[model samples]
Target chain A: GAGVSQSPSNKVTEKGKDVELRCDPISGHTALYWYRQSLGQGLEFLIYFQGNSAPDKSGLPSDRFSAERTGGSVSTLTIQRTQQEDSAVYLCASRNYNEQFFGPGTRLTVL
Target chain B: AQSVTQLDSQVPVFEEAPVELRCNYSSSVSVYLFWYVQYPNQGLQLLLKYLSGSTLVESINGFEAEFNKSQTSFHLRKPSVHISDTAEYFCAVSDNEKLTFGTGTRLTIIP
Candidate 1:
């Protein structure tokens, strides 16, 4: 069985530019989540989506950060006007029951 | 709301020696605890979890964690470690659908 998968294992972009990171959750997993991992900021929850329910965006640090899961499977995390602070590994996870399986992550560097 | 605290930012242990990584969490209600390990250049992998029933949970790789409700802790321990154990260990707690992760503890095995 395939685990959660993320695209663009690494991305480097200029500050103020927009970048989109993609995630494909395992089939049939109804819950998905995004998190950021940085040297100073261990791991921070970003957003979560559960089935047809509204996604939880409370963990998003600012308005510039947003994410959406379409058709209850694939998700994309978009950062507008990226900042140096946004440089980190973007991780995606899919949950089944109480356990969440994580993806390899996409490292985003804003130069 | 829930939060996790990993007191030690780093833990260096000799191969074949016992090791312990402390993790404490705070939450207003019942919560689920988990230990995720991230090897260098790899994604986070579930090590162990404590959901219900037993106070102690064990992973296949000789790692275990005890959920201590009284102390509000779920510390990970292993009787002996190997060189392959060098990695980053994250302790996370979930009160709802979202997880709160600790800063993470980097484990370095010294041969």
Candidate 2:
């Protein structure tokens, strides 16, 4: 079975530009989450989607960070007006029951 | 609010020596504890988790974790380590759907 997958393993963009990271969850997994891994901060939860319920956005650091899971499968994390502080590895994971399986993250570097 | 703390930012152990990665968590309610491992340029992999029924949980790769409710800790341990064990270990606690992670501990294996 295919595990969770993320696209654009690495991305480098201008500070003010917008970047979109994509994730494809495992089949039959209803829970998907996005997290940011930075050098100083380690790992920080960003957003989560559980089935058809409302996505948990409490972890989003700012208004410029948002994510949406469409058709209950694929998810995209969008960062608007990215800052140098936003440079980090964007990891995605999906869970069916308890343990979550993660994808190889997309490293975003805002230059 | 739920939070996790990994006291050691890094743990360097000799090959074939025992290693312990401490993880302490704080939550208002009961929580689920998990340990995850990440190699360089890779995603996280579930190492072990303590859910219910028992206080200890083991992973297939000779790693185990004990959930101590009174101490608010779920520390991971291994009797002996190998050179391949060099990676980052993260401890997380989940009270709801989203997990609160600690600043990971990087384990370096000394030859």
Candidate 3:
């Protein structure tokens, strides 16, 4: 793809439901990142992947939030037992650690 | 852990008026700085970046940002902003590869 691509632009789930968001980064991008954007809260770094090696996962808010990148290209973010507080725009970005290109984020709303 | 602080939560300016969005950072080591713009319900677009060149860098859209080592600032500015330029701007810094973003500053260009 010419740019990073994310799946399901919008998702609405009930409390305790699980949601999965996917991202397909640009071809040959060595670095990928997942971020969460909430009202009043800035973009929060959730996870990072550099060529399938993720050295950072310190920003995951809880144990329920997890993400993984496979084949160093496609990535998935999973939220277990989703809470209302988990509702936010999940953004996926890919780059070479110099500049990042973002995907149209998935707006996840937990009711 | 490097962090960014966008001084203003919102900035309002008339069309064709000059505007500056303040951003500051805190880090123990040299870092990469970036400015990104997010349009309504859209992905973030890279405006400019300060990697290692001159202290000042300009984006193709006439926006410029100065990387100040003393004040730890990378404030973004445009000589004259257009109504179409209204968007949410974010300041980000990466100590290594984990980018920490600041609370966004919404720029509203009033015609």
Candidate 4:
């Protein structure tokens, strides 16, 4: 069985630019989540999606951050007008019941 | 609202020595506790979890966590750690399917 996977293992961008990080959850997994890991902030939840219900975006730091999960499988986290503070590793995970499987994560460096 | 607290930011233990990583959580209702570990240059993986039935859970590895509801704590422990045990560990709690993570603790195994 394949585990969760994220694209663009590394991304370097300039400030004010927009970056999109993609995540492919495990098959048949109904729950998906996005998280951010940085030196300042250890691990912060970004968003969560379960089936066709609304996503829990409470952990999103600002309005510039948004995410969409298509067909309840692939998820894309978009950060608009990227800032130096946004430089961090973005991690994605999928849940089947209790345990969550995480992806390698996409490291975004805002220079 | 749920929150996790990992008081220790880093722990350095000698090889074959016992280690304990403390994790405490606060929530309005009953919650599920989990420990996730990230090795060097790797994605986070489930170390252990306590959802129901037993208050203690153990991973295939030598790691184990005891969920103490009275203390609101789920601390990870290992009798004897190996050099490969060096990594970052995160404590998370969930009440309504949305997880709240702690700052994470970096474990360094000293030779």
Candidate 5:
């Protein structure tokens, strides 16, 4: 069975640049989530989407972060004005009922 | 609001030795508990989960977790660990949809 997948295994961007990370959840999964893993921040929730309902954006650290799920399958996380503090591995996960499966993640490095 | 905590930042054990990774969570409602493992330069995979039924759940790889509602803990344990078990482990909790993850614990197996 295919698991969650993400694009651009690694990305290096300059500060103030905008970057986008993409995630493709498993087939038939109705729940998708975004998370960030960093040396200082560890692992933190960023956003979550369930079916067509409104996303849970409360975990987003700042206004610069936003995400959208299209057709209830794929998700894109956009960060405006990337900063050094935003350098981290962006992880994607999807769930059917209880246990969630994760993607390889996109490592964003802001210079 | 829900929160997860992996008390140990790192744990080192000799090959074929027993190991335990502590995980505690806080939530106002009953939640699903999960443990994930991330190898170097890789994504996370579901290690085990406790949604209902018995308080104990085990993974195919000989890892188990006991969910204690009163103690608010879902600690992972392995009777004997191999060098291949060296990786980063995460503890997560979910109330309904969104999940909260803890700072991962880096387990180093000394050969």
Candidate 6:
């Protein structure tokens, strides 16, 4: 892909249900990141993965939030037993520790 | 820890008007500053960055930001803004890794 790509442009799930969002980063990008953006709010960092290094998981809000980037290409963000507060745009970005390219994003709604 | 602060939550200006978006940061070590723009339904894309030297950095779309170390500010400016420039702008700072962002400023360019 010429840019980062994400699946299911929108995900509407009921509260207490689990949701999985996927991201396919740009080819050759070694760093991947996930962020959450609520309505009219700034991005909240979620996680960052670099090569084979231990992912920087310090930004994950809770144990329910987990992410995995398999083979350094595609990444998935999972929110378990989702709460209404989890409703937001889940954005995926990939970079080389310099300029980042981002996906169109997945809009998650917990009703 | 590095933190960023965007003073304005929203700014409304007439088309072709000059605009300035203010950002401040707090960091204990040398850091990198960046500005990102997000259009509706899209993920964030880098606007510019100030990593080292020159204090001033620019984006391809006529946006420029100046890094002021003493004041801990990286204010973005454009001599003229078009309606297309209306979007949410984010300021981010990173010491060695992991960018911390501020509440974004929504720039609405009115025609």
State each model's CA lDDT, in order.
Answer: 0.93, 0.91, 0.92, 0.91, 0.90, 0.88
Per-candidate TM-score against the hidden true structure:
0.97, 0.96, 0.96, 0.95, 0.95, 0.94
What tens-digit string does per-residue lDDT give for candidate 1 at A8-62?
9999999999999999999999999999999888899998899745457888999
Instruction: Indicate the DockQ of the complex predicted as candidate 1.
Output: 0.90
**CA shift of A76, model 6, Å:** 1.2
Instruction: Give one digit per residue, the lDDT tens place, for model 4 in A1-111.
Output: 498989999999999999999999999999998989999988888888997454688889999999998898898999999999999999998888877788999999999
Across B1-111, the per-residue lDDT of candidate 1 in tens digits comes to 888999999999999999999999999999999999999998999999999999989999999999999999999999999999999999999975988999999999999
| Segments of candidate 6 deviating more than 4 angstroms | none
In candidate 3, stretches whose alpha carbon ends up further than 4 angstroms from where it belongs are none
TM-score-best of 3 and 6: 3
Give the i-RMS of model 4 in Å: 1.3
In Å, what is the interface RMSD of model 3?
A: 1.1
TM-score of chain B of each: 0.98, 0.98, 0.97, 0.97, 0.98, 0.98
Cα lDDT for residue B75, candidate 3: 97
Best by lDDT: 1
| Fraction of native contacts, model 5 | 0.93
Interface RMSD of 2: 1.1
What are the per-residue Cα lDDT tens digits for candidate 5 across B1-111?
A: 889988899999999999999999999898999898999877888888888999999999999999998899999999999988999999999886877889989999999
Model 5 chain A is weakest, by summed lDDT over 10 consecutive residues, at A50-59
Q: How accurate is candidate 4 locally (lDDT)?
A: 0.91
CAPRI tier for the interface of model 4: medium
**Ordered list by DockQ, greatest first:** 1, 3, 5, 2, 4, 6
i-RMSD of model 1 (Å, 1 decimal): 0.9
Cα lDDT tens digits for candidate 2, B45-110: 888888898998999989999999889889999999999999999999986588889999999999
Q: In candidate 2, which residue pairs get closer than 3 Å at backbone N, Cα or C atoms, i.e. clash?
A: none
Which docking class does model 1 fall in?
Answer: high
Whose DockQ is greatest here? 1
